[model samples]
Target chain A: MTEFDREQHDHFLRLFMGLEESLRVFVRSLLFTHDEEREVMQEVAVVLWRKFDASMDGEAFCRWAFGVARMEALAFRRDRARDRHTFGDEVFELLSQTVLEHSDSLEAERHALDTCLQKLPEDQRQLVQTAYAPGVKIDHLAAQLGRTAMALYKTLHRIRLTLMDCTRRVLATEELT
Target chain B: MNTKDPRFEIIRRSRDGNASSEELARLEAGLREDTDFREAYVRYMNLDVALSAVAKAAPLPLPTAPPQRPRWITWRPLTAAAAGIVFGMLCTSVVFGFVAQRTAVKKMPLSVFDAGLEDAKQILNDGLPSQEGQWGIDHAKVVSADGKVTPLTGLHMLRLEPIPREKRVKNHTSRAYQVLDLRSLSASAMTDNAEAEVSASFCAANSGTSSRYLIRAIALDEAPAKATKNFWSKVESDGVVSESQRFDTAPGSAGWQTFSMTLRLPPGSKTLVLIFGAVPPEDGPQPASVHYLDEVQVSLLSSETPLP
Candidate 1:
């Protein structure tokens, strides 16, 4: 590749690395299965890389990247419809709109989320981490922990709700200050 | 926010892919109708993704090598032999089972509607005509009658005009509908033992106001006496239409798109109604909206177990 090409490649990589976590969150909000979400994110990354030159500056990167991610998620959902439990088009449309509208606020909340997660009690934090571990089945984890899968899921759900509430409160206070 | 909100449980189960079909349906309805529920659902999913990222960032400890086994310990030859035999049998069965499944399932396209507007027997208008002209199908205009613009296959396409707010006021609402009845074709092809998949290609150009385009699949016990007025009345009442899916069109939305939905026919249903039109905006006069529809197709798949 030419020097200019190499520089463009490096620029694309930097932007991708910076937005990778946010993009994953955006993709995950649209999909249920973890594997499918990751697959869609990978596809989005490739498409973003190819179209990086055409992307405008300012908040355009987030808008364009999330737009691409939305289409990828929709296509993934359509392909997996017959085999898996997937949300309908209307739900996805609403969810995508909500995410895009709140992207800035959500970015702020992400910082607050880190603090909220750190404040989680040791046992709850461990449960949250183990539940989200790569390739780790909730049923298997439940078996290892000597609890029913539903019970464990309920615990995780409660922990997530608590963290979300805490993050919202933190962000709200920050906005006030 | 109530911690005990059952909606949260539904959201959790949905995220985990553990939600039942009924729960999923309820969640979908809530997402469409309830704003607070939708916000909570998004926040919960965002939290799950954030937690997953954190978990992945935290490095896992490297595995330590196990201590060497004692020299005295050894595998039992008989147990090993039995295990090998069982594994071989299991692998053979799995391979054969997979091949059998692949060959047994069949996806057959029962019927395809590729003809022009002549095939459409009934055209019903739910709203009054605008001042420019009557709101109905225009067979003269052609927007890719050959289905090149859209993924539909047909020789002729129907251009449907949207009723303005004044026309909609006659119908008691700002929404207007132009319905095409395909009961003769669909009823003949439908069977109680199979599910029908209906799909259509649509393109819309909205004026200043936004409009919602919908393709509703309705099944009736019998054809209505007055197709236009009574049909809409029945649609207004519950239990008249089987399934309906909507697509929203903004001012700048000007491309052909395709949408498909599977309908489980209700018992004692004889006639099938396919309604296509735009829903008008309330409180003001609606901008002129035009929709081009073509290549409507319905295929049936038999729900029978294949012979081995």
Candidate 2:
């Protein structure tokens, strides 16, 4: 490699090396397996190099890298190959029973969720708080905010999806570690 | 029809706490008839339960672990095609990420002006009385800054003043015309009544037909037949008209025809609309002389009189 290219590669490596372990675990949950997760991380590194190879500032690189990691995981799972295990009645029942019996797993899931919430923007954090506040019904909050119930429902739907992904990643990495 | 199709209704009833035990059993029986529906409903219910539980419980600390790397990173490339495939996938994901980020940044719904109004005016609708028949202001004329007149058409309304011809003489000017359309205007459901009152003013006639124009007002009322027939009957009984004569300086005529008319509305009617039209006489090039209108007011009248 040329000197400039080598410098760029080293810059990308340093950038990838600095991301928090928690962020990595968060990204890995979106992937089906460890190998796929690793593949996504490498792609993230390559993309960071391509984007910021000229300057490679740490802040820009971290954001770019994690953002790329998330996309790669989503794209990887979007492939038809990952749909082999269909979610059916039995699986759903097992999942519910699992949640009921394994309180620690539920707690672990909650912990992962809290961590993910911490990672969100300050505005999003407040939104989650307001949504889940005790005795504050969704319909009442929606009316107070001049929003329809359907709109609030859709917002909660997106938040739930994000939490599921974050929790899955957190638990997966906790197992690995 | 499949029992699964009624799932939403049953769920809504359950959510509302209005479903009886028998109703719940019926819903459950319906759910069991379709495996896919039952599985989906179970998953949805469980997710809701878990999320609700988490929302209720105290926050917990999440695990911290290093992210895994891709398996292909350490693997040797087999061929140029394989390398190219890997490279392409990486590039595509990065582009997709960038696009998603940009889209999120915009945070606005992309909309175009296809609802059909000049200048993209929002269609005014609030349960006001709808137009009974074909109603709109179509013809218009542009007053150039150079004191010249130009014909306008296909444009319904303008909420802006007409830029005078002399002012529109050059690059420093804009071609302006007074336009109006009353098709989409309506009254709010909660409101009692709505009406529009407009007045047109014309500059005195010059050597030619510069300021001479015609003003026409059209109103469309759409309500139930009972309300409309009552409104029409009241208009026929209590309608007032006062006509007078006026002299025109340019034509050196003794008297010209002038008329003023007002129609009272009936009771129980919820919506009333008024549309005004101003047409000008035909000048040198185009025949219609454009007239300038002054004050136009739309007001909701009191609902008190009951129609017989």
Candidate 3:
């Protein structure tokens, strides 16, 4: 075989095997840990390898690979079904993927920070919830929620900083479509 | 804004601290220069108040305790003496039994994995013929609750009775489930050309983890076999919102895995095909025979009720 033949073989092998790494990255972008993402990627690669045809163009192949990855991710999500959570894994996966792809600017991150009310944990959620509620005073809320005025100040400060950081991460990772 | 002003530091430290009037004035001026800082500071102060309130409240609920046993009473001496005599004879038998019990019986309880396997076998036995090629031996195991294939056979002439919304589930290994609802969407054409559309506006209905389902259309075959590639491509190219996102898995995952997609059906399209097959890993076989599926669902995406 000529050198061209060897190069061609390498290209196909890369096409076939490199799909796994791309998928792993995709799963990671969905917030799945490296190992969990790899496990799912393994299943996807096996399926793709079996079904793939060399006749498929690169564009078609990428779409198909993405589709397979999405399906596998969904399947994984369904299998680990949780009853308590509101949004499903697919929505998060898609949203996260889209967000990461489209919105990578600092301005977007800052805006996300300004609107970072969604990611707060339980107590923080309640505090923000009350603060956002109509006509509620901070002093009255402090008294009702039973906080020392000083403690309330500190907690709010920490929450803002955390939200800012979280917003930056979220913006860096995702775009709203 | 320089740090050297002693009066500025005092203003910073004392919101209510025993600070002189002069120090307070200095702090106010510094805050006036940057409204954002003052806003952030006030926000922090408010949060401190709220967190303290929650901690003061009672703890979250705890799990219940087990039931208590009643106290035991002592027996009389004469009765106790008689009971001791009976116990002596019982003790001799118990000792003999203990010696006999030394032999290994080898009778062990079935494990959960074994139980799951047994359930899969039972499901295949009863569900295979009735499932009409919709069921394949994949990594997905048969869930006993929804594995009722026989009773559903020919009742609708379609072997797969979609596991009712409540009972249907996807195990980790299994990929997707396609329930073929052949009912036509268009009233004018009593034929199969009718289409179902899941547009972006209604994407919420299908955009989720477990609740999401894929759309694939396949013809009913005599042997419960898979549909042709032409069928898959036509349905896919026409109905799929993003062609790159269409996925299928091989038949052999040992159980049901879940595949979810947000489908936006093209306008004026007549049909939607959802394939619930598993995608094998890259290192695995080409055109792998992991599993096969013939069952699929056809419904109007925009309609309130899915076609039967």
TM-scores computed on chain B for all candidates: 0.44, 0.25, 0.24
> Candidate 1 residues B211-241, lDDT tens each?
5656556655554333444555665444444
Each prediction's fraction of true contacts recovered: 0.41, 0.04, 0.01
In candidate 1, the residue pairs with backbone N, CA or C atoms under 3 Å apart (3 or more residues apart, or in different chains) clash, namely none
Best by DockQ: 1
Candidate 1: Cα lDDT at A35: 67
For each of the candidates, the C-alpha root-mean-square deviation to the true structure, in angstroms, is 24.0, 30.1, 27.9
Best by the lDDT measure: 1
lDDT of all predictions:
0.55, 0.36, 0.33
Q: How badly does each model clash, as a count of residue pairs?
A: 0, 24, 64
What is the lDDT for A78 in model 2? 64
Per-candidate TM-scores read 0.47, 0.23, 0.22
Winner on TM-score between 2 and 3 is 2
| Index of the highest-TM-score prediction | 1
